[model samples]
Target: MSISATEGVGPSLWGLGATTSAKTQQDKDMFLQLLVAQLRYQDPMNPTDSSQFLAQSAQFTSLEKMEEVAAQTAAMVQAQLAFGASSLVGTTVTYATGPAGDDGSPAPTATGVVDGVTFGSQGPVLSIDGTDVALAALHTVTRPGIGPDAGTAAATPADD
Candidate 1:
């Protein structure tokens, strides 16, 4: 006998009306939990057939994998945040090389922390105690608290 078309794919036991909002990460978890409970209490005589059960199991597994990937992404973002944070420590910068600082004297280097992040991925601005400058706009970086050595790199010319 052909199984009913409604078999195994009908409204969930939680009685949520058919809505498209049930596809987000949180909803995926809830649906997996509900599917688990459904399997646990299904009638034995007409056991949830292997094919149907396996399909639902696959859905849950895929959802779990997506969650893992999301978690890894979050961790990578955190690590980048930490790296960006440490970039500001002792960065002995002289903002006196760009078109803005054309006289050739290094701008006053400031010692400070990454007060905040403004643009995304374009790099953050470094706030040295009292100086505010974009990391991208940095003229040169040296030891945490020392200006770039004029002897080793002053006349090398900007990288081609």
Candidate 2:
């Protein structure tokens, strides 16, 4: 016996009637339910191939593992950004203020001591003289009382 094209492929089969932006536990549960339903309603005279079933299970497992790894990686990156930003506290930094000039002129910048660091959705931001500056906007870092020519350190994004 053959299954109809619309029988197992409809949204109703996976309980996906509700729209969602991201995958949730409900979605995973629905996927499992769909798989079970397929098995329960299949033609027993011609059972699903064992290898095909194993491949589908493997794909599900791989997808779950990949999502876990992605979440972990994001957390690690956030922690690293926080650590790097914290280190900038108490150091004088020059950071870009406005957009860069298009006529071969250098972008305007402001120099101040980093008073604190704050983490936001966009990553770490440095608090300097009552202004918030993104970590990525940092041009140089120096010790207190040190001039740019005397001892300037370049700021770059941290790598794994």
Candidate closest to the true structure, highest TM-score: 2
**Clash counts for the predictions, in order:** 1, 0
Q: Against the true structure, candidate 1 has what lDDT?
A: 0.58
Q: What lDDT score belongs to each candidate, Candidate 1 first? A: 0.58, 0.81
**Candidate 2 residue pairs that clash:** none
lDDT of 1 by residue, 92-159 (tens): 55553235357776555433444443434544556665565666565555663344444453465678
Candidate 2 Cα outliers beyond 4 Å, as residue runs: 1-30, 102-104, 144-160
Quote model 2's TM-score.
0.69
lDDT of 2 by residue, 1-160 (tens): 9654344544465344444225565567677777877887889999988888898889877876776677779889899999989999999899999988999799899999999998899999999999999999999999776764576677999999
Give the per-residue Cα lDDT of candidate 1 at 33.
62
The TM-score that candidate 1 achieves is 0.40
Q: Tell me each candidate's TM-score.
A: 0.40, 0.69
lDDT of 1 at 83: 75
